[model samples]
Target: MPLCSGYMAPEYAMDGLFSTKSDVFSFGVLVLEIVSGKKNRGFYNSDHELNLLGYAWKLWREGKGTELLDKSMGDVCSVHEVLRCLHVGLLCVQERGEDRPTMTSVVLMLSSESASLPQPKLPGFCMGWNPNETDSSSSKHDESFTVNQVTVTMLNAR
Candidate 1:
């Protein structure tokens, strides 16, 4: 799938540099989005301007991470499993690419219940649109981006 530039790692977003770690960062964002059933972009909270990552981080830090789960999936999933996924997702979106786990590590972390995962620092692009800014018409600090569509297909081996 072709993701918007919003999912790009901070280094790649700012410096046009990308690597495997960038992919890790994107994966982390995906994981968080999935767990929350929310898109990283176009997500708005009445309480604050926090995007999905910021909101998730806040909840996790406040010992209310379970509230981040999508209510539609109520009673259909394991709280422990969901929290684990949330943790793994946060780890993947760490501000520094090097802080993110490799794909191999991600797989293991997701699959192992006993794995000791490290706490994630603030994620890249955690801030959302700040409505308090008076310069809405100015594009100088605009984070607005155009979406590009790309289709991906995977063939299964029998």
Candidate 2:
């Protein structure tokens, strides 16, 4: 979606630079979608590319974020609780990593009703690719190293 929208921010998108905040942003979007039963990437409106995140932000600023709640939830949902979750999600997606809350803080916020929340900054790339293939490459490297070690051990024994 980043590539398609041309909205990929240079810091987080092209450089493969990401931090916990990046995960936070993703988590925010995920939570929003879960609550609203909407998809962020595929959302469409005649006037804007405003995905679920944008739409939620708009509603939030307008004091109508509660309106974005999934109609299906009906009376089961708490308006204040939902708003708090949405606020925390937005804080997670702040454009600058430093501005985002750590997972620890997020958990605290979620669990503690009295916790003070920080104001959220504008969110980073609304969409992008995952560049962390290190886990896959590390496994391949480990296999190669094991093979090399076996070859050396055999030669020494001979």
Candidate 3:
């Protein structure tokens, strides 16, 4: 199976499990990226080394969720709607698969303005990885391969 580490849920990354909830988690990442106009992978913040999700979570907790909106939008969208979408995005990226909302629930949450949203827990895969940990793996091996013309790079447990 083909995999991109950025969108993989913690359970799938660590345990090789995939399910609807995993899809939901990916969707959540997509939503945050869309709102912030940033990629979840390789996202950089000067103040912290957090990924896009962690940065979004931090902004949301600090009551600065509006700061996450793509500035180029220039008031073209409703602030309420944008924040609502961000809230739903956070809900979908909760650390535990079971804590994530189903796609059905996601649709309803996005469409309903009056409905209340629950607080989001810590998101999965939000921490930065160590750059110098080559010897951490028990096995000593080096291999290279490619899929669909894309070269396989480093592999790490996120």
Candidate 4:
């Protein structure tokens, strides 16, 4: 019953840069949610304040990718297939649009057992994006962003 607005691609939510690439990011988030049985938004993890993508990426980097899966589905699906989907999901959420796979490529990767896949880099919005986090470069950043609202625009000229 909740909207997972956090799954919106960073490049889109921050700057309104909608494209096929943005769709790919959203798809990745959905895949992660499905496999992990976690809401992309309104997720809570005491280990970190990161969103689903951020936490999933962390788990992947730690070589604990299987831990990100939903335990309920353990008996129903192949772990290899699940891991492949996780890999593809991470690939789709890469920070740069050009690095993301086209839908056709993603489909092939998902369906083929022999497909050669590349390791995925960090996801967009990789950090927790905590405003309370203090940085030494505070003077170089904007401090006016409120808790529930970000005055983002298509230009994103801030």
Candidate 5:
């Protein structure tokens, strides 16, 4: 999934940032993308920078989570189950790691019809700026700084 490739890359591990919670976030993103048939990254509109997660959040908050479902899957899926999945997915992607549910909790919420789920907090990195706009001078400088830091750290560890 994109999360494994994006957030959980080995480079992130170098910073000791890898955690089960991060995996939960990735899984949540995957679930939303799968249900919506859209990519979470680079999802945009003229009105908002929201990825699929943001869209889902807005729908959920508006009591319209069902609206986020893929139209192709109409009547083939249970509305309650779909909503529950969306809720769990949102919980997994909350900005605060501590606010995110564990993968075990996610599995339970997905599998059990009777489980009570807490409301999900806001998701992380929901900014709408085009991620590929590395053309800006400031972005170039940031990239160089990151690359240099990685190089120096690696050399020092070796």
Candidate 6:
């Protein structure tokens, strides 16, 4: 499957390579979105000048991870579990495919409270915006495409 600019992993977006790791990346973004109640795509924080992932990482590093939680949950949610979800999300979004945990590992981490989790590196899309930086979204890939004029992508994992 061709990659969409948003939610596409570096491997797939940069080299047209699609695999389970690519899905892991997308799942990470989804987890972040669910936890923070924000969409990864079109999520721009002006103060930090970062996308959702970068902003979450920023909060995490500053010892303000709890602030990243959705306001509606408030004091009702379990802080430790929420933090673990964030940790797992970051692990799944590491820049390299090899750095990401498999879905099996992810499920285990999410399920077992005693499971030890490795610390996550910064994250992909960390430097989302820079005024003086040269950036372009116009890859050789089209903005979006259709298979037989159908908008949805259909592909099987190896």
TM-score to true structure, per model? 0.79, 0.70, 0.78, 0.76, 0.72, 0.76
Q: Number of the top candidate by lDDT?
A: 3
lDDT-best of 1 and 5? 1
User: Positional deviation of 61 in candidate 1, in angstroms?
Assistant: 0.7
How big is the positional error of residue 12 in model 2, measured in Å on the Cα after superposition? 3.3
In model 3, where do residues sit more than 4 Å from their true spots? 1-4, 129-158
List clashing residue pairs in candidate 3.
none
For 4-86, candidate 1 gives per-residue lDDT tens digits of: 24588988987888989899989988888888899888675666567888888889899999999999999999999999999
TM-score of 1: 0.79
Per-residue lDDT for 63-106 in model 2, tens only? Answer: 88888788999999788899898898878766677787888888
Q: How accurate is candidate 3 locally (lDDT)?
A: 0.85
Report lDDT (Cα) of residue 146, candidate 4. 36
Number of clashes recorded per candidate: 0, 0, 0, 0, 1, 0
TM-score of 4: 0.76
Q: Which stretches of candidate 6 lie over 4 Å from their true place?
A: 1-5, 129-158
Question: What lDDT would candidate 6 get against the real structure?
Answer: 0.80
| Each prediction's RMSD to truth | 11.5, 11.0, 9.5, 8.3, 6.3, 9.7
lDDT of each: 0.84, 0.68, 0.85, 0.81, 0.72, 0.80
Candidates arranged by lDDT, highest first:
3, 1, 4, 6, 5, 2
Worst lDDT 10-window in candidate 2: 1-10
Error of 3 at 27 (Å): 0.3
RMSD of 1: 11.5
Report the C-alpha lDDT of model 6 over 1-158, residue by residue, as the tens digit: 21223477888877899899999999999998889998876666776378788888888888888888888888988999899999999898887888999999999999999989998886766545433433344345565543565588889899
lDDT of 4: 0.81
User: Lowest summed-lDDT stretch of 10 residues in model 1?
Assistant: 130-139
The alpha-carbon lDDT assigned to residue 102 of candidate 4 equals 90
